[model samples]
Target chain A: MSIFFSLFAGLGLFFIGIRLVSNNLRQVIGRRLRQLIARAVTGAGSLALFGLLAGAVMQSVNAVIHVLVSLVTAGAMDRKRAFPIIRWANIGTSLLVLVAAIDLHALALCLVGLTGIAYYQQIDQSTRWRHAVGALLGLGLLFLGTDFIKSGAALLRTEPWLRLHISELGLWLLPSFAIGAAVAWVAQSSTTVVVITMSLAAGGLISWNGGTMLVMGAGLGSAVSAWNLAGRLQGSARQLVLFQVLLRLQGLLLTFIFYACNRWLLDDPFNRLLDHFQLGLPARFAAFYMVVQLLSDLGSRTLEKPSLRWLEAWAAPSLQENLSKPHFVHDEALDEAETALLLADKEQQRLLACLPAYLDALRQDAPAALASADKRQAAESQVLQLCEQFLVELADRQRSRDVLERSMVLRDRNRLLGSLQESLAELHQSTRAVMSDPTVAQLLDHLVQSLHIVLETLAETAALAQPDAEELELLRSLTHDRSDLMDSIRRRLQGSDLEPGLRQAVFSATTVFERCVWLARRYVLLLDGPAASPDHPK
Target chain B: MSFEHDINDEQGTRLVSLKGRIDSATASAFEQATQDLFATPNARALLDFSAVDYISSAGLRVVLMAAKRAKQAQGRLLLCGMRQHVREVFEISGFLQIIDSVADRSEGLRQLNA
Candidate 1:
């Protein structure tokens, strides 16, 4: 009963210690972590070292994984570049077990006291220093938790029934492996399981071979937990999680092969080597962890191509899968202002790309073209509405004045596009209505030709990021030309004899055409106007 | 479309009845017939548009041009008997403020002569 109590308390403290340390450390490092990741991609070695350093400070591999996943999702870092960070982070996470193996309770306690004193003196006014104090306290709690786990294992060693149960089942290795995996999965931290394994090994409660098999299972358990944590993610983010699982599986395979070799040989080569270094059970346990990590890293580099091919086969479709779906507004990206803004820009471009096709559909005189135009309008309308909702959510999340202004500008542009679409539909309806009158039909045919030119120019100018001098001049000329032609048609209509309703339909068609030109001009100004200004160059 | 005009002789007042749409198709005809009326020096011309169902920007443009010509000829151009839709067009184009509109031809004649 005492053994169960100690073990439960130890596990509880372990969970709290890890959470406190990682959360506070993350708070201290906040934006700097993102900046470090940005700079870390300069070289493969730097990226690996960055992962190691970050994991060591963050003290939780899951936190490092989240940051890497976010960077990949935001398109800041390629998935290929992100693999090294994940690989090294697993290695960095093993470092805590090594540190905990040593008796650092006294030193950690002293550091905790000093930080507490500093905190009480109000020396930690800045959030960073306060986080530093919290981190030191977490370190103290971790050391204390290690002590409790060691004491708990020692208590369990005295229980004859528990000893018999473990000793009777363990030599097979598979049962121990399964038990270790179950514990690590529940704890969500293989490092904690490893620390517990070390305690049992040091207490002479478990054999070195048994400890190694358990560690292998812990590795697999960490991978499973990582998969669970990233379950909601898709595309490259989920791909990274799969790669992480593959990395752990490789480590398990290496450890299993090494265990098999050691079991086959009468000499017991690995244990003999441990004895040669004058290492104890604790040191050997940590060495096993370090060895598996090194072997996995090597395996990753050698099997990079096949591993990537395999992962790609299992990868989800990218955000650009369907034009009607929301592409740029990823939920994961909303956490970062820059990434969200960039995604919004991409969505705007996607919607703009649909404009030319819609106009072409409108101008087509065939029955099939009209049907296609309706379909295109429906898709474009759905996409535009989704994009508007996305932009509004993005703006609500972001506090920057620049982001707000950009979102507003984008909203305005989208609104204008929507109005233009409505006008085109109205024009289509009125144009057909007046077509039944012979005199008006003749005029409508001439107007359609002129209107097509204006629509073509609008579609062309809208697609450009910035209209050149000639294109701008051409747009102005075309807009002026359409206006003049509409005026002349209006004057001609005044002289022709027609029914009142038919005349009204033609007049409305002309009005709709004028509005279309106005919208086209507004679209040009939105894309190139302020950005091209001297104070805000493109 | 269809347009009907009735010119009534009164002291310093003339009421012309217009029916149907005064749009691009009929604006010129409406202007051509009303041109001589406004050309009468210091004569007040009241255009009753109660029967007119619609008016377009082109019709508004012509009306504005007639107003300017009327003012230049030292005559007044008055509008009356406009339907709701026609009044909305004038209101939307901001022509309502520029052109004088009344409840009926009598009110238009009263304002023009006054």
Candidate 2:
């Protein structure tokens, strides 16, 4: 087959292989992997190393970051801690390209083929084999893309117009860096960008230096994604994002200088030794990129806190958006304290969106989720503060008694929502504590669900006192139904071979739900128009 | 005990009646009783926790799943025949809000029958 045709075939096969691998492996080892990530440290060095490894494994830096971001938001790690992990992720990702550029197609093909068989092997025992295919598919895509760039470059060896585009290497570096950064930001996968650049280099499409420079530029670009995710969180979550941006910016500055000096120092003997002999241009470039990446990643890892503090000093004043004033939620409005408060509320609403999920999560075992439990409480407190702020403003504006009642109901609901998160967190902890007795441990997931259904029902009905007969009927029946579930759990708690911690979490969740119902009950009283809290009668 | 579940999609109700106890051990069976349809009624479901001599979160999970399933379908989950203890379970634990509970199967029959 022609080179282009071969390249296309390889690329297609490669992607298919990776899809199969990721899925199968995810099935086989998803929990172990998630636990490892959840337990990862806050320091940049370790995080970056993990990133690198994940990037290397997936051969997609952007994909790793995306996964990391999702994990972080899901409370696998504090957003504050994701900074260095991202740094190392980049370094690890670059290695894929370096290996590919060396033309290790045979190794790539073998791994992809064996893993592909395991993936499509079609047996219950080999379920994990299916995910192995996802890994290979990624590798295959890497090779196929590389092959395309190489043949394309071989064609370029004869094409003069593109050659005319080459002599301006330094000028090209500037644009390519910007281009790589933009592409990485948009595609959200640094590996893809680097692979493309590597393909161009192996094909002799871009000069050796051009491809290397772009790889470096890709590093700067990958940082933007972490910034966006961190921006998506509340409080420390927001700070974590800014910290990531600072690390990336410093790395970029250093990279830019390195890129600029690379051309001037091309004639240096050490570089000359790297360029000539069996080492080759791309290999030398790879070595240089590796050293530079190690330094920048390590530097960012060490200096992230201090460096971000510096970046914040300069950038905070220039930020224009404020969450407090109700601008769109995605505004660059990072630093304003007033807006930050409002932003926190938006985050709480977002958390509310996760109520069902939280309910599901709580029904399981949660040994690594203590941090998430803490975060849930913090978010609820912030929401309460926001409601209080809004309430104070409403009272000052002379809002009506009915409006005040509505505000109180809303505030109470918000508090209940927060309590639910803690309850769920505790539920998970309890489930783990009692796992030895699967019967009792398994019961906790159910108990939490029973509690959740009630909270949601109240929210749906709004606990209006004079609720229509249908509403009353519905409420009475579901309440009774849930009571059935609770009784069984209590019995199990009383008699089962469960741990003390497990028993306590279940008891606590059961209690919180009951109290929330108490709030909902009073809410019904409020529909009596100030009759709910007679002491503060209108 | 034999259990039969009928889903009235257009009417928005999942009617499940069981001849056995609805306790932790049997809840999974209760849930499987209606696995054929995830969300009840797209708007409402009728659960007969009556044959349920006992109920637990395992049963509540089935209820919550049904509730979530019903809510997503833009319907409602209406449960009935929770014994006094069952009634207390929903009351003290607060599963009532997320699910609509009634006194007996007749109440659900009346609600859905109408």
Candidate 3:
């Protein structure tokens, strides 16, 4: 009971330590991880090498693979680079097995003490130092936990019933293999299973052949674990996990054939080599594990190309893949300031193109109920919000004076357009309530007709390279005339015996109408240059 | 938009208080409510614009139209309690030139009766 308690406590502490280190390290790295991948990794070889280093530093190949998956999803790295990186990350898992084999309690304790003092002193106030300390603490806890697990497991040698059961199971390779695989799956760490198998074999409880079968099962167990995990993932991530499973299966097949053929070989050359070297069973088992890993990685070199092709072909991106990405932002335009400005201008024009459609929606006959009008307004708001997002993204780009000026104009224009649309939507809602008032209804109809004219002129002028002075004058005159028209409507309503609600409806509709013309005039002035602005008053 | 009008005396000096947004939609109501004030006997109109939040060009045009009519009737159109932003709209559109403005109701009445 004590042994079982210690074992579970150790496993719990191990998982917590790993999770703590991974999460904190990710925060410490933050966006620099993407920057590092961009700068340090160029080709497949470098990417693989970097992946190995990242896995070793992070202490979890699975964690490293998840980072790669995120990078791919963010469109920060291509799938081609991710494939090699994933391969090397898988190779890097061997480091954990190697570390677990040797006792690092003393070194881990030293690091813990050093980081503890550093943390106490607040030597570096940055999050980077804090994360480093956390990682050291996690490493120390992992070392301590492993020691507890090993000590607890050592007691199993004294239990005769367990030994008898193990011996009975060890008589058949398949059952022993399955038992090893099952243990690894439960622990979610094949390294733990391999270490236990090595300890059992070295203690003279399990034979060398039984240890080999257990190691073989550990490989399949890892594959099963990855497949179970990858089942929930999509795109390049799922493909990489699938590839990992296939690679493990390949290793399992090779190991099984070697085990079967060794029975007929003279004196079992593998065991003879371990005996001749006077190495312990633990070292011998570790050596076999590494050889299998190396062989699999080497064999997988030829499979990489076809595997990547298959992944790409199978996980063909959907059309909506681009929905999350900015449609107007092209990477090539970012290199040149002028080109970027031009692209932003084009994007602004695209937003303006939506103006006609928005106006058309407003011009349509009133809906049957208030709820439908609200729904239509909500949908229109979302579309306008998307345009605003795009405009904001464009505004964030670095630009020179000319481009900067243009961006400012476009940003202001976008804002005013959004305001105008909001007012129009409000007017539509009020128009519905006041539809029974013939005076209000007629005024709304006339307002809508006038708005259409203003919008068409604005849209046409936006498309021109330079709006002629006469055209600019005409727009300004129309703006003045619209203001007068609204005033006359106000005067007419004031002379009538209309109810307050009907009068208020006409006022709100006229507000949007006058502002639309004002906005058009402002935009025309913006195009005509700062000197022609109404604020300056030509 | 709303209009709260009070007749100060038998001489018919009217105090008209406006609130909320006065744009094209509400301008008609505003004009309708205030148009009759200037027509009253011995009428001197004082409009309070402090609570008004915004005025589009349409609203400014109504103010200008009222000012012109008040002047024609030999009645004063005095605006008081204008919010800074709303006042700026009036100033920018040159509506301040068309109507007399005072700081508050007392000042507006003093100016209108003067």
Best by TM-score: 3
**Tens digit per residue, CA lDDT, model 2, A1-538:** 3645644564455445434443444343443364565556645566657777776765554445445544553334555566566666667766875785445456666765765566566533354444445555565655545445345434534556655665454457677777667656644445556556554555566776566667677667767865665554544335545555665667777766765665575555546666566675556656666765666776686786677676445444211112222222221222332343334334444544444444544543222332344445444444444444444444344455754554555455456555655655554454544544554443444455455555455444542434455554555545543344455657767787766776776666555555544544543333333223433311
| lDDT computed for candidate 2 | 0.54
Ranking by TM-score: 3, 1, 2
Tell me how far the alpha carbon of residue B82 in candidate 3 is from the true structure, in angstroms, after superposition.
Answer: 43
Q: For each prediction, how big is the interface RMSD? A: 11.7, 6.7, 9.6
Error of 2 at A60 (Å): 3.3
What is the RMSD, in Å, between candidate 2 and the native fold over all Cα? Answer: 20.5
Number of the top lDDT candidate? 1
DockQ of the candidate models in sequence: 0.02, 0.12, 0.02
Query: lDDT tens string, model 1, A1-538?
Result: 8877776776677556656665565455533454465666769789878888766654556656766664654334667888888888888878877787445457657866887788788867775588777766766666566556656755655678866766643486888888778766755557767777777776677887678777888888877877886576667777887888788788778777877888785568887888989998977888888887777777777788899898888886453323445666654676875666566656766665555444343332322342344455555565677567667877887887777877787788778877766676667766664565666664454344344545555555655655677556545544542465567757877788877788888888778767877777677667654322233323
Alpha-carbon runs more than 4 Å astray in model 2: A1-52, A67-82, A95-121, A124-160, A168-248, A258-284, A306-538, B1-114
Local accuracy of candidate 3 as per-residue lDDT tens digits, B3-114: 3433344235677778887765677888786777767545678888877876654566567567657756777788899977676555434345446798887877777666
Per-residue lDDT of A133 in model 2: 53
After best superposition, candidate 3 residue A296: deviation in angstroms? 2.7
Q: What range of 10 consecutive residues in model 1 chain B has the weakest lDDT sum?
A: B88-97
Ranking by lDDT: 1, 3, 2
User: Model 3, residue A419: displacement in angstroms?
Assistant: 11
> What DockQ does predicted model 3 obtain?
0.02
Q: TM-score of each model's B chain?
A: 0.88, 0.74, 0.85
lDDT of 3 by residue, A29-112 (tens): 533354566667877678878877765544444546665665665545666676677667656766656665556557667866
